[model samples]
Target: MEKEFVVIGLGRFGGSIVRELNKLDIDVMAIDSDEARVNEYADIATHAVIADSTDETVLKSLGIRNFDHVVVAIGDNIQASILTTLILKDLGVAKVTAKAQNDYHAKVLDKIGADTVIHPERDMGRRLAHKLSNSSIMDYLELADEHSIVEIIAGPKLEGMSLLDLDLRANYGLNIIAIKRNGHITVSPDPGEYIQRGDILIVIGHDNDLGRFESKLEDN
Candidate 1:
């Protein structure tokens, strides 16, 4: 079976997803109540339609239930976003990814059965803060249960250290899963592998452990 996606609200978030999916040669349907916005994506999306998604009958007509995934990215209109998500779930859409305007909105989306709730703005802010606070951290991603995956640069302190000598998993409850160097990546490097200058360590651990690891790195 061919998989398909439905993007409601042809705003920045939704529109971007549509275009990216198109670039991947994936089937995507773009929808917006605004005629102009819908027209803007007509040439880009596999299908573009101007329709109010708040109405169940309209969705039924569009055969929305059969789509593999649906993203409700109604901009600024929290009520519409919530309503559309509710309708999509009620219609048994397999996966519903909704953009939440804020924390309370995310909670409601979760309670109402949104498979994934994203705060793009808030998440970007947090990600930037992590990088800024610790120059060693190039990137960070938050995970459930207060865990995170981080891309950190090795400092002079670790230049000659091997994974075995460091014993990161035991000492800091962290795992250096991969090493990136000079645009090349080494996955699951040997325990005897020594760290060199400019090596980027892809590590995963609980947030507290990560924080401790960062502080320890900064001290060196």
Candidate 2:
């Protein structure tokens, strides 16, 4: 069955989520207190309504509990965000994800039973910093404080070398989880698989190890 989602707050973050979900053909209902914002996604989302999610009566009338997932992306309104999340949990929503403005907000969301609390700004800053520090790194994602996954394009030195020859795990303590070549991805590539220049390698490892591996690629 297709999953249903109700996204409250039509800010940049929430708007992006709704658009992406729509691209995937998912059912999404977009809601916002601002009539202008709600109208913006009216033609895009499955349903768009101008409603304040913090009000219990408003949520109950919307039948929010029937949705598989609910996302509270209220911007600069921590009280509303917290209140909305608490009401969703109280109504027995299957999953609730909330955007946290800061550490304290995240803690409150956690205590109120938010399934996921995301710091989009902080996470995006980290990703941008990683990309800025390494020219070879195409993208970065933080899995944990010390662990990360990165996509790096193979350079001259990596061309024609098989995975067994490079021995990335033994040499740099990094693992190439997958390789993308000519738009096709090969997951868990065999040791004998030869790496070609321009191939994009998706590697996961400790931040320090990833840094060291990136340095090696730079030196080559």
For residues 1-220, what per-residue lDDT tens digits would candidate 1 score against the true structure?
A: 8789999998888899999999999999999999999999999999999999999999999999999999998977999999999999999999999999899999999999999998888888879999998989999998877898999998888899998999999999999999999999999999999999889999999999999999988884
Which candidate wins on TM-score?
1
Model 2 stretches astray by more than 4 angstroms: none
Expressed as tens digits, the lDDT of each residue in 130-198 for candidate 2 is 889878889999885689999998888889999999998999898999999999999999999999999
- Give the Å shift of residue 75 in candidate 2: 1.4
Residue 73 C-alpha lDDT in model 2: 95
Q: What is the lDDT of residue 218 in candidate 2?
A: 75
Stretch of 10 with least lDDT, candidate 2: 211-220
Q: What TM-score does candidate 2 get on C-alpha atoms?
A: 0.92
